[model samples]
Target: MVTRKGEQTKALILEKASKLFNSQGYRASSISDIMHETGLRKGGIYNHFENKEEIMLSAFSFSIDTMSHFFSEAMAGKQGCMERLLSIISVFEGIAERELFPGGCPIMNAAIEADDADLLLQEKVREAMDGLLGMVRNLVQEGIKKGEVKQGVDPEFVATVFISTLEGALALSKLYKNQEYMKRAVHHLRSFLAQNCA
Candidate 1:
């Protein structure tokens, strides 16, 4: 029973920590920052996590789960592959507009920071990215099967282009503090989807 309660507390800490990490880069966020955000003492935090890295791993998982939930929610009730894909783009636009994570895409954030620095975290980021790309590829393939997309269209190539385009747009949007970049990307992507996928 005590262990169960401890697990719950740890989960709560992870949730809070994930938001902080997403909002502020990992290196910029410290244990003290997590403690402050969670209203837990350092000892309380340490009691749940072995160290900052452990907390970060858990937090990254939490962030990914949160993003997945958002994607699922946005895709719900949308019919066909193109609609579903556009729904994802809409979700990204919403995230940028509302600062849903307050620091743009969590996967991108961690990937940029963890590249060649932390093997474990980098692996986790790579896995998350792979899953995302797989989702896009699967959607494109499904569309082809349903005769919604061009039959000869290469799903892997489409997925890669789609992911890279959005990531680039997101980076530029965040860097320029302008939503127009994301908007234009979405528009162009929609056009591509209609022309090639639809």
Candidate 2:
């Protein structure tokens, strides 16, 4: 059985590993990197996780949870589908401005790195993406029910466009080392929503 102290140590390792993996990418971050960040020896890490893959899985969960909390906080006072959806973009823009995760969105980073490799990591990314898509879809559906959004709008299509646009914009922003890409994407998204949503 793992002791309370052991659980604390494991959580610490996961927290540090999440940041390191997000900044360095999964394959680029080695055990030594995690050890250096967490100040734990190999034995300590191994005592909690069976391997690096195990650590990575936990770290990804940590990253996703953190991102979810950030979005929730951003959406707290916002109402309606348009407001909630725009809040997501606003949060992403804030993340870019503040360098919240160092490298960028953890899910996007992991998805790009794990594509065509690391099936397990890829699956985790897919689940995270699905969760995000579902959130957007639910918001849109709620808006339709409340008469806040256009009755004919397809929640699935809107969610897809919103997510894909943001992801693509984030990638370009990171690639070009400029926030304008994200800002422009947000502007276009807002315009699209204004035209489509009520």
Candidate 3:
């Protein structure tokens, strides 16, 4: 019974922690802040998580799950691979332009801020990126089969370009706190896709 309760507490911590990290960033959000937000004592927090890094990992996983669900749903009911690809872009463009995260893309934000100094965070970021790239790669391969994308077009290459542009757009938008940069980035991405597909 106690063990189950402990697990429940840990899960609760992760849910709240993920939201806090997403909104305030990993650096700006402290354990004390989490404690305050969850109304859980420090002892209660430390009982489950060893440190902030562990919480961060949990938050990242949470973000991945959330993001994957959104993309997967968007991909559903789409016929051509190219259509699925466009839908993916549409999701990102809508989210980015609308300020979905209020802190921007959590994975991109974490990658830029924590990649160099934090190895664990970097690994999580890499995993998150691979997840994103995998979606694009799968769609591109499908497009090739349907003659939507060019035959010689490399799925991996296209995925990489797509991921890079989206991340760059998020970074630039965050830096200037301006949505125009993100809009321009997505426009360029759409143009690139059009050129490749045509």
Could you tell me every candidate's TM-score relative to the true structure? 0.95, 0.94, 0.86
Provide backbone clash counts, one per model: 0, 0, 0
Q: Which pairs clash in model 1?
A: none
> How does candidate 3 fare on TM-score?
0.86
Task: Give the per-residue lDDT digits (tens) of candidate 3, residues 32-77.
Answer: 9999989999999998889899899988898778778877788789
Better of 2 and 3 by lDDT: 2
- Candidate 1: how large is its RMSD? 1.4
In model 3, what are the clashing residue pairs, if there are any?
A: none
Tens-place lDDT per residue, model 1, 1-198, is 459889888988999999898878898999889989989999999997899999999999999998999999989999999999998898788777755777788999999999676999999999999998999999989999999899899999988999888888888988898999998999899999889865
Which is better, 1 or 3, measured by lDDT? 1
Model 2, position 177, has a per-residue lDDT of 89
Q: What Cα-based lDDT does every candidate model obtain?
A: 0.89, 0.89, 0.82
RMSD of each: 1.4, 1.4, 2.4
Global local distance difference test of model 2: 0.89
